[model samples]
Target: MTFDSLGNLYGTTYEGGGEKSEGGGTVYKLSPGSSGWTETVVDHFLPTGQYGVAPLGEVSFDPHGNLYSTTSLGALGVGTVLEISVNGQSRIFSFDRVDGAVPAAGVLVDARTKTLYGTTTGNIYNHGNVFRIAASGQETVLYDFCQQPNCTDGSAPFSGLISDEAGNLYGTTEFGGANGLGVVFEVTP
Candidate 1:
């Protein structure tokens, strides 16, 4: 979960929305009220559709107060990055397993540029990758994991990314380092 500037807490559920027995999940907000905290369902993921479902990441806000997140499954049975604004929700990008797939984390928005960065747990090679989506919606794979011999560079990044003031990205992988026990890595843009 993450807190917005107004102190409202936002998060996503893997299941529990719509009418299906295995619901498609929901994005919700908790606002501190005079009496206590009030919960509101911001967006409900439908069990069936092309829009995507099962959000496994937290929500991020851009400079314009638009919210962003990733779904672990649905859009063509892969996943998608979504943007929610006052105008409503839109899928900004979808994973086709060529660029990347199965994003288990949310995106980090560059407040100045409105660009988005995140990691995927799987790709065509099942090694995962770190990607950058430009403000214009063009996606670029900044780094593909397991590029080195014996995958010493790491693989299967199951988390999101963090950036320093200099714009270096830091994240972790679930497996494939020197010891085959995953690794902490850094990428320069």
Candidate 2:
């Protein structure tokens, strides 16, 4: 699902309303109603692996009203990020390891530069990396962890990051810090 400009919500449920996981998914819309709020299931998964498995990530809308998101499992266990248009048209983006395999979090789009950034659960150099996936789908490693003694700079950033108005990126570590209880830090471009 995706978010409209006014903050109304839309999303999907992979299973449970009927035949379990094989029945595909359900597209839903959540919006403020006069008395309260309402939910509508707009579509359902088709039981074909090509359409995807559970929808496990956040959804974002492009300026042209196309919705985009990824599922943790689908299309051969490697996962996929797909685009769903307002006319109900959907297609996979042909994502693979070069885009930082297994993205476990949502993508952050840099508004000014139109760059897409996300982190992965996969590891390189014994730890995960912060990655930037450009509009052209070329991904670059911005930082790799466990490079320092005691990893004072932080390690294993499990969640993704956000950049402030000044263009500083902020994120957290699941391990390795002053006291090892986890820490939140920022990076400057």
Candidate 2 lDDT over 1-189, as tens digits, reads 457887678876646334644565555778887887688665555646574556655666666656666555566554555666756746444344443445555566675555666565445344555676566655677766556778776776667678888877788777777887556767665
Off by over 4 Å in 1: 20-22
By lDDT, who's the top model here?
Answer: 1
Count of residue pairs whose backbone atoms collide, per candidate: 0, 2
> How high is the CA lDDT of each candidate model?
0.92, 0.62
For model 1, where is the 10-residue window of minimal lDDT? 16-25
- The alpha-carbon deviation from the true structure for residue 147 of candidate 2, after best TM-score superposition, in angstroms, is 3.0
lDDT tens per residue, model 1, 1-189: 999999999999998877757679888999999999999989888867676999999899998889998998998788999998888779899999989999999999999999999999999999999999998999999999999999999999998899999999999998999899999999998
